[model samples]
Target: MRGYPGRFDPLIYYGKLRLNQTIITKRLTPIKVDRGSRSATATLPRIQPRIIGATYLMIALLADIGGTKSQLALMNEQGAFIHRRTVLNHEHPSFDALVDQFLHTQPPPQCAILAVAGPVDDGIRCRMTNLNWLIDGVALQQRLQLKFVNLLNDLQATAWSMTDPGVQSRLGMLRGSGLNFEQPVVVISPGTGLGQACIQPHQDQYVIQGTEGGHKTIAPFNRLSAELILQHWQQYDYPPSWENWFSGSGFSRLFQTMFPGAPVPDNATMGQQAISDPDSSSARCMELFTQAIYAEAGNLVLQYLAWGGVIVAGGIPPKLGKLFCQPEHIAYIERKNEYLDRLSAVPVALCQEADAPLTGAATYCKQRWHESS
Candidate 1:
């Protein structure tokens, strides 16, 4: 079997030995039956040892770490859901505290993959933007008695989870010809911040590349957008980036900018007011948010040439999917592009699944296990 270099040794583990034995025995067992007083024992065919090995390899520890809450799941090799749980990270003092709570309740997994809303390298160290936690993959593995550990940017895992056939049902389609699975896929998610990535096509496989492109300055396509951004630049002492008007916080800031004398509504009131009136100040803020998202999607589509499709995943887009589906939003998206005709050929899909990031983490672990075997 293929192995991860410089990681845990499967042969030296007793739990793996027992798991292997259990799988092998199950494969070899047969049953006896009697039909009309005629009894016969049937011999079950011998199963491939690799198949047993693969089954044993199936079990993995997966976590989807988000800004407010974190989700953990234990999954088998076939991507079957086992045990799932969620914890509020804000209540936990540190990452260790959160991991400790999960370990106390769940069985120790053979291998682990953690998906975090931050950049990751070498599948080890990670720094989350919203939480006061610094995670070390190796340390968590050692403490939890894991064989190997992998880390992925949250959006990268979301892109990976998109490979599952079931994801199609949750996706609300937008303009485009259709999906060409063979081509590279692009992911753009708007939440606390914007997340972008491309699922590059490999021979009979795909690789997701996460990027911090959300931080890139957003070039305003209209005078209104330009004025809104420039206004914030004065206060922030930084350029008005896409994130300023594209995120939840950005929406509030934009509302305050558009109607400075209006009462500063709390988060709840702002959301409620926006829903109440699409033309209200709150609604105007949301309009800009949608526009920024559409603009970014177009930019990424052109940059990646994502003929496969562009997927919108995150808390915001799915809830506002209907609004985004409107003709004005679609037309606004097409208007900003110099190559509108070419870009129009690319399809855009929205992922409605709330726990997509968690599913992606599990899928990532499964793919790694399969490749190793």
Candidate 2:
């Protein structure tokens, strides 16, 4: 009732494990259910592997909260994934409600690592860029009785997966000569909003840094892109930021403005349609969007000198299919006037996994555990 009407619903499970009703594997512990007026209580099934000489095994909870959906995963101290659950973000009244509903049916984790679609405040709080929700690490820790709770900008967490060997195997190269691990890595995600981050190895570990590059001033690549920016200015009374042209809402808005019809109401549908029907206006919209993405990514590469590589994550890139490989798109990415030679050396790749943020959060938790040990 607290959330938007018709959008809010009872917590729905989308993973292999269930509450007391369904039985999982031998590792699953018995469920303890607690009833509450506002939300039900359940403990996360104790699926931790036994460790000799260790009195207790460490269990981690990873949450990647985005605008459209949230991915939840459980992992062990050793960084082995246990299970994952995807829930629509709007279905729950609040993030706390969603977590409560989840733990209400299962056991709670000792440490909770969350990757959210916003800037984190000292790893303790976040105000989502797209969702009308405020996430507090301190509050979540107390509410869940968690030993540790931390928040990371979605891209900051996704940066961890940039170096993951398994994640690398799934990447689709778009441009650049090759990757060099010695250089810093950059990650750009255009989903509900735009997210950017840089990761560099230091002292036997990676130091992840968040960036507001997505919110920076956007430069149009051509006259058509210039007109789109002018239109955006007319409507908003300010220059459109990179996210305005690089995000889902931006995709639909740009398409409708250019085509003068409401063919598609959202970016997800429009993107999917563009893939299936290459001749449609949706395709044109996506092409323009890709160009903007390329330009912004190139700018980041030049600004940060991220010669290691640039990884594109979130919901858009994967859907673009082989579009990045097209000569025009590749040319746009390498069109830095004076820095063409330097930029051409930078690699660009799409993160093929939809759960890269979840994997990143799990990796973050694992690293923290070891550093503290």
Best by TM-score: 1
What are the Cα lDDT values of the candidates? 0.73, 0.74
lDDT of 2 by residue, 66-148 (tens): 88789887776567766668899899999999887766655447788999987889998999978899999998888777777
Q: For model 1, what is the alpha-carbon lDDT of residue 131?
A: 74
Write one digit per residue (lDDT tens) for candidate 1, span 301-330.
778877777788877876566577765775
Q: How many residue pairs clash in each candidate?
A: 1, 10
lDDT of 1 at 259: 81
Model 2 stretches with alpha carbons more than 4 Å out: 1-49, 52-56, 89-91, 105-108, 231-236, 260-269, 276-279
Clashing pairs in 2: 41-104, 42-103, 42-104, 42-105, 42-106, 43-106, 43-107, 44-106, 44-107, 44-108
Error of 2 at 58 (Å): 0.8
Pick by lDDT: which candidate is best? 2
The worst-scoring run of ten residues by lDDT in candidate 2 lies at 1-10
